[model samples]
Target: MTTVPPEAERLLENEPVMAHFATCADGRPHAAPVWFRYEDDTVEIVTTGRKLENVRENPKVALSIQADDGGDTQWMVTLLGTATIVEDEAETDEARRRINEKYGAPSDAYEENELVRIDVGTASYRTY
Candidate 1:
């Protein structure tokens, strides 16, 4: 597993931060905000619909998270990686728990959701 940088690690673990999950299909880009869990040097998100379909066709993906307090200070992190649909029932269940907890979702919610894991290949951040 690749080691997550300290700054990126903090951002990933923060529960309230929303990540923009991006995928490409047929040269078109698609992105959406998501509640995510970062662990074992991987980013996991439970989602379905077009995002899932895009990753199925193209494993390459990106995740961007930013913070803005409406002040001069701002920071952002972007992670580039390859995403795989998680098929193992056990892993999917765990992912569901983590994602739901992060977003304060009811325990029963997201149980039937699909899981996607992104193995981060590169990460970059900017602060100002």
Candidate 2:
């Protein structure tokens, strides 16, 4: 796995912005906004329905995050990675708590969602 650059990691860890999670399966692409937590070169997201199904079908995924104020852009980071569905309930719950805490939501939020961890293989960012 490629390590996330320190500058990009700082932005990823500090920004509470939404990430655009993208997945592809059978030539079709799916993307959705997700609340996520970034730590130790891994990104955790709790999701269900189409997003979850797509990840199951395809472990390869991408995440796009940007920090902006009003209409002005500050920086954007894109990550390409391999995703794994975490089936352990305890691990999923812990991931949920961390993700929720990042977004300032209740610890028990998104109880029905399953956890997916992406091991980042490539990370690129641009600051404007």
Candidate 3:
């Protein structure tokens, strides 16, 4: 697995920005916003519905995150990775808390969502 660059990691961990998670299944692509936590070389997200279904069907995914101020872009990062669906209830709960904490939400928020960890294979970033 490729590691996220230091500058990109700092941006990801410091900003509470929404990531655009992308998945493709059966020749169709889907993208949606999600709250995420970045640690080491992995990006974690708790999600349900179409996003969850897409990941189960196809583990290949991508994520895009940007830091902006007053609608002006400052920096952006894009990650390409393979995703794993974490079925352990305990791990899911812990991941939920971490993600929620980053976004300043309640610890138990989105309890019904399943955890998906993306093992980043490629990471690229740019600053404006």
Candidate 4:
């Protein structure tokens, strides 16, 4: 697994930016915005539909997040990883808690849903 830089890690943990997630479909790119949590050097997401189907067929994926100050400052982080469809209920529950807490959602209202774990293999960032 590739190590995320300290600054990038801090940003990921604290920033609420939406991640642009991408998966391969028939050797082409399919991308969408997603709410995600960064933990244990992995990116976690709850999703269904085409994104889930794409991952099941091809585990490789990419995600990117960016932040801007509305002035002259901006930063972006990109990650490459292998995505796994989590089937274990226990892990899914834990993912629910973490994701909800990160977004200030009702933790007790956690619902069982499709979970995806992206084990990050590479990370890159740029700030301007």
Specify the highest-TM-score model's number. 3
- For 50-107, candidate 3 gives per-residue lDDT tens digits of 9888888999999999988999999999999999999999999999999999899999
Off by over 4 Å in 2: none
Better model by lDDT: candidate 1 vs candidate 4? 4
Residue 94, model 4: lDDT of 82
- The estimated TM-scores of all candidates read 0.89, 0.95, 0.96, 0.89
Writing each residue's lDDT as its tens digit, candidate 4 over 34-97 gives 8789976799988778899899999999999998787554889999999999998788888878
TM-score of 3: 0.96
Q: Which runs of model 4 end up more than 4 angstroms from their true locations?
A: 71-73, 108-112
Best by lDDT: 3
RMSD of each: 1.8, 1.2, 1.0, 2.0
Clashing pairs in model 1? none
Better of 1 and 2 by lDDT: 2
List per-prediction Cα lDDT, in the order shown: 0.85, 0.91, 0.92, 0.87
lDDT of 1 by residue, 1-128 (tens): 55567876877787467899999977988999988899767999988889988998999999998888875548888999999999998888888887788888875586767899999999887888
Would you list the rank order by lDDT, best first? 3, 2, 4, 1
**Who is ahead in lDDT, 2 or 4?**
2
lDDT of 2 by residue, 7-123 (tens): 988878877999999999578888899999998899999999988888888899999999898989999999999999999999999999988998899999889999999999888
Point out where model 1 deviates above 4 Å.
1-3, 71-73
Candidate 3 local accuracy as lDDT? Answer: 0.92
- Off-target runs (Cα >4 Å) in candidate 3 are none
